[model samples]
Target: MSHAIGAPLIWWVSDYTLANESALIVGDDFGSIAKVKLESETGLKDIEIIQQNNQQLSVRLPATISYHSHALRLYQPDLKTFERVWLNAPKIDWLQGDMGVKTSTGQGWLQLSGKNVDTLNLQDAFLINKTGKSYSLSLKESDPWHAVFNLPKQIPVGSYQLKFGQKVTQPTIPPLEVFIVNQPTDFQQRVLNIKDFHQSEDSIDHTIAFKTALADLATHGGGTLYLPAGHYRLSNSLFIPKNTQILGDGNLATHLIWSKIDKQESIALINLEDNTRLQGFSMYHDDAAFGINSPSDRVINNVHIEDIVIRMSAYRGHPTSEMLTKIYDQILKRFSNKLDTIRLQANNITLKNNDIYGTGRSFAFIDSHGINIQNNKFYNGRRGWYSFSGCSEIIFRNNTITGADLMASGGGINTLGNKVSSRNLYFANNTLGMFNGWDREAFTSDGGGASYFGHVQSHKENQLLLATNLRSKGLRLTPYEGAVLFVVDGKGVGQYAKVISMSENLVHLDRKLDVALDNSSKIIICPLQENYIIVNNTISDAAIGIQLYGTGLNHVVYGNTSIRTGGINLLGLWYGGYQSAWYTLVAHNALYGSANTRKFNPTRTDLHTSNITVEARPRSTDELNLVYGIVIRNNQLYQNNGVSIIGSQNARKNMDAIFVDPLDN
Candidate 1:
């Protein structure tokens, strides 16, 4: 076959091996070819030309291949052509068996057994340092689900991760890391000591020393920064960088005291980064407000904090009306308080086995996801433990809160939802109470909550036309994709649909409306809260144990006990004159009071709903306050208000509270 005056034409190949496999490359006009090469980012290598049959070239691949979508370059005198191919044939899920980086000898090698390792070509494989320097590898053994590669001897001694395939941009399965040392005995001394950076024992300021140690460790990759049994004073906040850990001898032995000279400004004494940890230490802050924080700007992944104690010595007194106003302002803007002891705005965080005592809100999480906070104790002097707007997949379990003020706005595991919405939250196996003598009755207004704006205009097949325009606050182009729309009153009651997209005054739903709705029907669009589980918890001396206020749906409150508490109260609360809730299950609980469903007024003085509103307070309107699809079953109500319905609002018109199997035991 003769080719035109372009370049050497490539027809096809028998096998495009990413590994060491013999293959035949058949094409036209191969007589004038001088060199055939396989090129990747690492470098280039010449392919061995075994023989030629007509227009075919028989070749053998390199023994150790490291390529990803590389091009095969066929070179001739002033005539060249390229053919690109993807080399990733295997799926590397996880590793097992002897995946060690160090061999018996002084040299370094990787021998591992993993899923689908045999089909891989070791494409783009490297051992990366913390400073982002990569070293190449040479493969040795190739077997089913097993691999062996020799590491370069010139690679420096440090901590490194064995990374493969494409560079990761999001949080996913992490690559394996290993410590490279000269000998096995050096492994015990791998931890960097914080005292080594200090020049003199007389130095009261350890900030410079701490920063110097962190920079030094980051230069040679990352490792743990150890603090021995001693007290250190820091004038500035310590920002623990990514892929690092700051550990102490023990929580009782090692202490970090924040002596803030600036009294007015509030800043976190410790700021955490992605892939970072702070453990085995006791932190004390007196002058400044915040204890530890993860800022929202920095996208974090997989942070673990354990065996630590955060104590605020200068406790701010009970929150006044002015302080509450400031909190409401922040909430309306979907922000958190600056004075929270531990304010986290990151994802995939595990905070456990710690004791936190704060003057204001002990814990405040905003716009975060996948947070697991368990086995912890919180002591609050003012507000309480709050998980605010835009948080989801949160598990708050096996924890206890004491001395909570249970303020009218919120207290004790509060989930305050807003436009971004809170979803997939859980509170289980926890204890919540106030330490002071039970002077104030426990109420639902003091517990969990969710709220948002609502107004109904017209309803179509799969859309809800709204009266309120969402184009304000720069939300014109922003679609309310994950929000929920519920027909809470009148014709289409008990049916809800998820928002697929939204225009200025229109909402597209996931499915068509099952029940026909008219102008008299009251529909609510909740961008506040959804899909929560509050179960297996113990509460005492609270006016309301668990409350789902305002707009929420598909929430489960089961297997909880209330001792002197007001019991589980679900309120279809009016925020900015509208509210709705549906598909809530409150079952198998023991309470001192009756389990109640009510339509509450936020503006009433006794209602205590002013906690969440600043300027945009809840106003009494003609629109319906609605709660439907409520199931209260097998609950032991000690009082006569068992499964009682309060308020003669529109919720009583078509309120669906299904009582089953002995309404009250």
Candidate 2:
């Protein structure tokens, strides 16, 4: 039993809802955990417990074990967050015994047992954990279902595997993420001020001083170029250096106005190459603006971009020949490799808590290896975020953009490339304007949302002052649930949550995946991009949930449910080419149950679609209905409208193949 009172109490069995209320009551046993075994789909999802109350003690069943469609051989204290794994041998376990073992991977085996060695075959399965470690049922005398696992100190970030056999595969870019550090072998913090450098009265030779500052930043001996609360006009460009910080006085009054004449990102652009940062400054450009723009391979990696605002060039239409030539000569010709916004050929870019606006024919673009654009706002812009050729891995969490319909442009977050396992992108807790887009948009089953992983809230964790003022105190927004059954870590350590908790949580990889269901990381797509698995995620304000472009084979859309204009619109799988979309199982979950929200259909205002999306603004609870799995079951549908098991030609070819039992209620 659970109690919903002053504190919180959790129970193995409880009820959950989709309202703005607490799903499960967290009683005084706040830290207590418990384990519950469910046989059917609906039973598995009967309750909506946010966290575990009592420790779950899972004792292995006596000996003989039966094979299942998808077994919880390895516990990943996360939501449907399993490391993609292909079994090399038939799984082995016990029905009811002390324990039976199955060699799941090279280093690990599914340890199943109870009181005896070989006897009573168990009926159900259970998994639990903390961080780095996972194992078979917890059979300790005192506790049964839940047992917290210990994790490493500085646990390695990024995705790894829990092999079920003897293969060591990898993702799109196991490309080493090398953090370019400062010179002298160690990181030394240097600080500069507006008084340290300035524009000459004539503004000519003053440009020389600007070059000196730029050269210093380009070199090593990392330092900060601090600007007090005043406007420093630059006749030429202000350059960026490696292992350095260009800081501001932390006042809204602080301003750095770039020479609009340098619109081509010449004097206005900030170049980076390993270990670079830009903090606390309002960059006002006359023509166009740039925060950090480096050449190919040259990047500002392993750094932070906090409390900054960028204003782009606002030329009405075209520029004068002189201005264009000057722009080309001063900017383009110099660094044509640089894109419209910034270019980090091969680096890790984290753009957090910043304000960016680009009107006219300008947009913010990225050409990096791993890019994280989070907790930011965009006013009136032609484009917001884009993932061009070189970009393979990306994460966008808690960001908001206003006028996406100002100009005829591309997507808000465009992640497209022909490369395999290309972009391991992530989108959580982000909000987007529904009826907004520069181009004529199309409506689909989902809201405009197609972001990789869905979540709630459109905000980011910022510096101290911002944190104090920005985040709401006692409000816990809707987030990913379910699948935390595989507890990787406990309260702290390297505890990763379920990756597939969100109805939109999906993982697709060429290699076998063995991850915790409750995870907060990116997914692979092809060797260029592939590992994207979605589980119990929610998406009410989206147009389309999951859209597959190329061949989707052996892909399982397990336990993912969403809502938008229609329902889920499956693409590409129909026609050939990438029709390799096989073994995809979209099972036990909820879909658009909001018949009323359908009212937005005829009155739907925003409809522009993009690559991937999620709800940014903080919401009451996980919105939408109670549908699950990519394979919609006939019996499940019957629960709502009692329909018979039937499939169309295309549905039989795609959905039916993945569906194991459509008739079973």
In order, the Cα lDDT scores of the candidates are: 0.58, 0.35
| 1-665: candidate 2 lDDT, tens digit per residue | 13222222211111111121221221122332233222323333222233332322122221222322211121234333222211111221111110111111112112221111111112211222234342323222211111111222232323332222121221121111111111221333555554667645655334555567656655646666666776766665665666777777652867766554455555335665566677788876655445456654344345457788877654434789886556545544443423354434545556778886654322344445555566886544443323344343444556654444333222332223322223333333444333233331221211111222222222122100111211232221123221111111212111112223222223222222222222222121112122233333344443344444333322223344444322333332212111222222334444443222212366565533322211111112322111111233311331132222222332212221122232332
The deviation in Å at residue 640 for candidate 1 is: 5.2
Residue 292 in model 1: lDDT: 82
- Model 1 earns a TM-score of 0.60
- Model 1, 257-296: lDDT tens digits are 8777343333678877766778899998764367888865
By lDDT, the best candidate is 1
Q: Count clashing residue pairs in model 2.
A: 164
- What's model 1's lDDT at 238? 79
TM-score of candidate 2 to 2 decimals: 0.48
In Å, residue 603's CA in model 1 sits off its true spot by 23
TM-score of each: 0.60, 0.48
